[model samples]
Target: MSSGNPTVFRTLNERVALTLLLEHGGLTRAELEQHTGLSKASAAEVLRRLENSGLARKAGLKPGNAGPAAQMWQLDGSAALVAGVDLTTTSIEVSVADLTGRVLGVHTTDATGDVRRLLGETLDAAGFGLDELDQVVVGVPGVVEADGRRVRQAVQLSGWSGLDDLPENVRLENDVNLVAIRELQEHEDSSFVLFWVGGGVGAGVVLDGGLWRGVTGRGGEVGSVIVPDPVTNGRRYGQDGGPLGALLGAEPLAALAEAHGL
Candidate 1:
């Protein structure tokens, strides 16, 4: 399957090479050719373009006893700065990282505080500034609705209106879906379900190599599930449930534990 366009092919080759270098830390010309299925000349051209773009650089020579010394190319970690935010009901945790996924700095603040301000503070701690951040990913415990503009059914992130006036580089996502992303590497299966249980319960459904966020972004509202439990009648979170975790969130769990004298 050829793109039949030289420019497109070149871009694809460069992206593949970058992913290889990022995953392997560094790779020689031959190693890249082997992994990317690119010819020696094509791999060399890709690496040259990556270097020119400042996305990659020659790290050093590979430890080999055969032939000429092969140059090991690595991703330029300083090429871009990115931020990840873990936003919860009470607290927000921000971490600034580079292209190679190295944590540059971290900052924590109350959820009620301004997230943009917290991001600025985190970037400052990383020896950078808000202007230098190329992108930011926020993981919120809620159903990202309205094309990711409005967060609805967030039983957790209540009262806070959120930083809706974010720049184009900022993105909001469901936290449990992000957690389910890790399962892809753990299993080769294209479909699996990851259950997030702690403060709340949610499902991360991966289908056909992607997280199914659903049309309305309520794909995995497991915490709202209802099941029957004959033992507990008055303690139900709502009507119509059968031993479900909807009534077993953090507060309810604590209440149940205290009632058990544990």
Candidate 2:
């Protein structure tokens, strides 16, 4: 039943187990076995790996019951820091978090045309240089390809074509996708869509606990969802600022209501 990547898979499972321990507090190995559905041996193996990686440690013995109390595992809370950057058309925010997802440092800056300089500078300001980064998740407001190289379009930023330079390890994901991922991480069973009605109208779909990255990675582009334009009586509006302006000003709603004789 091994997938040929037992080490890698078990390491990931150990991380999941550690997350469960953090959320529910310490649990016995039997409890972990039930929660993770791993065999007792696999669970023990992962626990050993977690302890070795310094991400988790064995806490003191749990009180009561039987001859010897089981040693509980707890999150180290400061292992392998991760940085998340939310880059928008006008603003940028950088946050540093430990392995436990605890925010350690945060900084914000106004975004210029180029974000590399801003990212480097803000990362330095946060005292978290690129070398210390275990992972950098960037939430961008645009359609990013699978390679994260070319951006189809960013609704908030006009004339923004694509990124000039992106690091190898940095993950560039759509803002709404990031939102969905964050939501799913917090509430795994919740099924919902994130509608971002800011500079433009767009949505990120979370169906059956995963993002639907379609053929072109443009599956959730709600702005491209063409419906009959009420003002023009079933005419299609191209992706532009006109519809957004009307939506913001309530003109579109009013026009639709008037057209409907309401």
Candidate 3:
């Protein structure tokens, strides 16, 4: 999908072209011109601009194709750095990836009552200093307010409120919401809901190709839906640690399993 159209030469044009190239891999100037339906000159100009910005580069010649082998332009996927952190009650996953969504390094550790220490160590292990990060996104298990300041109702996490003290520029999001975001962005599919039944059940909804966090950002709490609990005299929900984990904690699951069978 070459972006050959004039596209007004605004920031959006560059973004669109870059996205096209990244998604489709390499494309020759002529191919871009054809795919984007832009004049050859326009395509060349955009390609040049992207190359200058260190966002795109020539990736050798097109191979085994019919027409004359042309220089293929590809996204300079390693040019910039972005970090993503998935924090849950059970574990934390930290990764540094490029603009092309390629993970350069990753670290996963137990979420043992200290997310900050784990975050620092993971960043170090992933070979990314705080300075190198152009953007930081933290996805945690809780309801993230629109301002992204408050972590409301993170019952499992001990220091949920301390997230406000993180690097001021970092973006905070619900882990389930992040999953839905990744699903929608990576696949571009609409009308989907990601139900992550881990440590605790969580969900994120995507409608019409966009994330629907709702007015309060607590849109995904499928586990909270009431169900019968004879022992409690009220409705109950499965606990976190996923279904099995919810059904049986370190203490109860063992007893139930032993009593039932092997």
Candidate 4:
């Protein structure tokens, strides 16, 4: 049920319709209503708003069973563009995509001094200016605060903690969390755990079709778990070389594999 506020209801309906079009391609008014469970009048109003905003358009006409042809609507992918940046310890990868998630360009370069400068270079390589981007999603190799302001525990990637002059629309997310998001989207029915054993060790958990972000947004800091110390013969708390970290971390695991002649 829609709230009494017409503006809120209209905006919600527009979003629902836009999401459906983006996911399912072109759809007729009746089809939109059927899929969205919206009334005929509400669907028409939502479509009108979407077309007015230039976010959607009538793509073609669909032949109805008995009545006249019905107009088909689809999202205008070119209306907006977004960028995704994967910032790792050794390299930075950037991809420019449209509203419909079509990758327009991809660029990769070595990790450099200035984060903002690298972003600018990536945007230029993608044939777009910063002004043209609607949003920029940055995947960093550490825990990002829920507010998306700060990054911590990413010692390998310096100059990211105090990133200045970043664009207002930029978003910082943990690399593991981004991977978990991709996993969730690819497998909607299954919940699973994702382990990232790169320069650092981390875990991402998805439960009941949603990412389980615990308190303080550090739900997957499995590397920090304390366990028995090999040398001390006692328990020790360590993040980089803790028990879980020693077992699953890239460097330690690689060394172990070499020692085992595998």
Q: Give one clash count per candidate, in the order shown.
A: 7, 0, 9, 0
lDDT computed for candidate 3: 0.75
For residues 1-262, what per-residue lDDT tens digits would candidate 1 score against the true structure?
8549988878888888888888899999989988978888888888899999999998988777877788889999999999888888787777888999999888776646566666566557557777778988888888886466556667777644546766677788888887888787666459988888866788899997878878867888777556754336544533454435656667666766777787
TM-score for each candidate, following the candidate numbering: 0.86, 0.78, 0.78, 0.85
**How would you encode candidate 3's per-residue C-alpha lDDT over 1-262 as one tens digit per residue?**
9776555555766777887897788888888877778888878888999999999998999864576788899999878889988876667778888988898899887656555566777788888776678888888777778877667767777643357677755788888887788788776757987877666777888988888888767787666554433232232443322333354344444655666684
User: For model 4, what is the alpha-carbon lDDT of residue 222?
Assistant: 75
Instruction: Give the best candidate by TM-score.
Output: 1
User: Considering lDDT, where higher is better, how would the candidates rank from best to worst?
Assistant: 4, 1, 2, 3
lDDT of 4 by residue, 1-262 (tens): 7459988777888888888898788899999999989989989988998898999999999998898999999989999999999898777789999998889999887766678887888789878887789999888877777867667567668744345347788888888888999888778867899988876778888988888878878888777676554432343344333566666666656656776687
Candidate-wise lDDT, in order: 0.77, 0.75, 0.75, 0.81
Positional deviation of residue 98's Cα in model 1 after best superposition, in angstroms? 1.0
- Taking all chains together, the TM-score of candidate 4 against the true structure is 0.85
Distance from true location, Cα of 39 in model 3, Å? 2.6
Give candidate 4's error at residue 164 in angstroms: 4.5
Off by over 4 Å in 2: 1-12, 39-41, 65-68, 158-162, 186-191, 228-262
Q: Write out the backbone clash pairs for model 3.
A: 2-36, 4-36, 4-38, 5-38, 198-242, 199-240, 199-241, 199-242, 200-240
